[model samples]
Target: MSTAAAPAPPGDPALLTGAGARALFRAGLDTDTVGWAAASAQANLIAVPRADAYDLLLFAQRNPQACPLLDVTDAGSPATALAAGADLRTDLPAYRIWRDGEVVEEVADATPYWRSDMVAFLIGCSLTFETALLEAGVPVRHLEEGVIDPMYVTDRPTRGAGALSGPLVVSMRPVPAHQVAEAVRITDRYPDVHGAPVHVGDPAGLGIADLGRPDFGDAVTVGGDVPVFWACGVTTQAVVAASRLELAITHVPGRMFITDVPHTAYRR
Candidate 1:
């Protein structure tokens, strides 16, 4: 299926919990009111069936950089022990239903997509790193400017597996030259969620010459002090696109499945 540009709608800030977000997502999907990216980004989801959780976790294992494993619950259970205690079927805002590698329909609830064979996977996100950067007083242009992070498909390649493997995708952050090393040191601690940058300094070193453009997220300013590049969770999109799996699920870039686990846990 072709990629459709999702429309940007003002999301209700009140829908923060997995249950609340899922309900809104389902309503939005039923009405086709929110864009694909917006729905997935803001929605909170729970994976009920053991099989669905297994499949999702396995997919993440197959692609570590893009789908860094987070947490999983007991088999056939709806609530995850770590993230939130919301029902998986009704919590997410929307789900893009797929069948045998094809985009069949966009559904509000994945309960219809759930089979006894399905599994839920909680992939790591770039938002954690961004938070680290901001905390360290690093200049994150996009967030400061109220824009999306600029992502690009670099010529660099990533490790691959049976159904996963694709180009190395990098998320650009214009960090001031002075704090680049600090950014690396701070983010390096969260290995489970794409810790540390894959590259630093020059984009050309990573075979990326241009900074004005990106492959996935929006672009922001790159001043003299701002050096570019970091590993991204969005790389999973490329792997998903390349593998062309019969079916897959992921959080939209910028939007993520926010867990109840505190940021301190990731530091360990």
Candidate 2:
């Protein structure tokens, strides 16, 4: 849970100067996370102007479950990040472009996807919830087995806004019968990202009949204990698919948009 701060590479002289570094450094004092680390990495590669940030945030906002809003860069300039020090254009390991809800391409760099009107948004993931489970001694099988957590589409629906609304997506973890209450207590502290369990026990209660085959991520063994489900950041993507917008983007399932802000920020 504790790690050293990663150093940001340098940015382009024409697009970014040392000023951005100062801004990022100040922001980092308040928050830090893996996604922020990637953003800092990109600032060294190219200019992530405010325009680029706008595109990134707008994309995330349009698809909140998948792209939670973490931090944003200034609108015209690239120097200040509202949340983390990382730049948006280069830090991410991969970027997916979608046309009318269909992903058309995947690339390492998002510079081509950059447009002045766009904004960046960072969504919450089950990572924070998993942390709470681990602290309570609830075995998180996916992490233990070195596999991604299993995700499934449920009959549950989320609050719809703008063009986003669809069936809820959830990430599952098997909790011992003894620690279920402990898991709930620890996670209830944060709600900005999905907070607390949406469903517990039978998966069928949420329209998920098969635990062995998941709609996304990998499946893990479910012992004689209860199978727990939490709201997923990817739920927004399901909404996007249902909306059928002309253009949309999201991180691949399991692949997430990291941010500099600590997971604790969601407590607010």
Candidate 3:
């Protein structure tokens, strides 16, 4: 694998296959995957010790909108049902290593930090629905601006399960005022990947004081469009931090594990 940082593969990212995207990351392309493999499904990864797996699973079940689960690997395994022949440790653009509620390090490959008892959870990501939004003529501002999508932590609390609990996290997109309904209509079809906007219009309703400052990812200009919020899988990181787990592994914010599953597979 190349140690040098590489740019996105030269081509239309929307036409890239899931396996093709993984190959790029495995070879050392460390960038957010917002528009890459637009036709395929993408996932947020959160791998925890087997002892804590049950609690995390319960948390997802209790809060499906924020933590829709696509696949959960058996303990100690690096493979997932979502992508055949893919190595979880190195296939994502980046990984975060957490220790006692704090992000200790971010790395291109997670193999050095992986534990034998780890149980990897593949949670559905909102990025999986972007293709649908674009196909319906709804603009994805971050993609248009060539920046990462912005994510925020809301004041709303998630349902607790065992030792796992945290505030709801959301990803925001600026939708044309006239196309807000169409955007909602398109996204609502993919319930497995954060179906629809949890909150729209005023960011203050979600307790977000400023649109320019975001907790994770880059903030984008909203312009005349309405700000729409969707439940974010990054809520797992918030839970990892809030619960103060001894150790946890997750995909970097905005960087996801591309899956062979097509976006249509999750459409309602």
lDDT tens digits, residue span 122-166, model 2? 466667555445655878888667677899988987655544567
Candidate 1: tens digits of C-alpha lDDT, residues 14-111: 23443444444444433221122221222123232342344445556765655566765455454655545555554454455544444466554556
Model 2 CA deviation exceeding 4 Å by range: 1-83, 265-268
Regions more than 4 Å wrong, model 3: 1-8
How does each model score on lDDT? 0.58, 0.57, 0.93
Ranking by TM-score: 3, 1, 2
Q: Report the Cα lDDT for candidate 1.
A: 0.58
Compute the lDDT for candidate 2. 0.57
Please name the candidate that would achieve the greatest TM-score relative to the true structure. Answer: 3
User: Which candidate, 1 or 3, would have the higher TM-score against the true structure?
Assistant: 3
Candidate 3, residues 74-140: lDDT per residue as tens digits? Answer: 9999999899999999999999999999999999999999999999999999998888888888899
Worst 10 residues of 2 by lDDT: 38-47
- Model 2, TM vs. native: 0.70
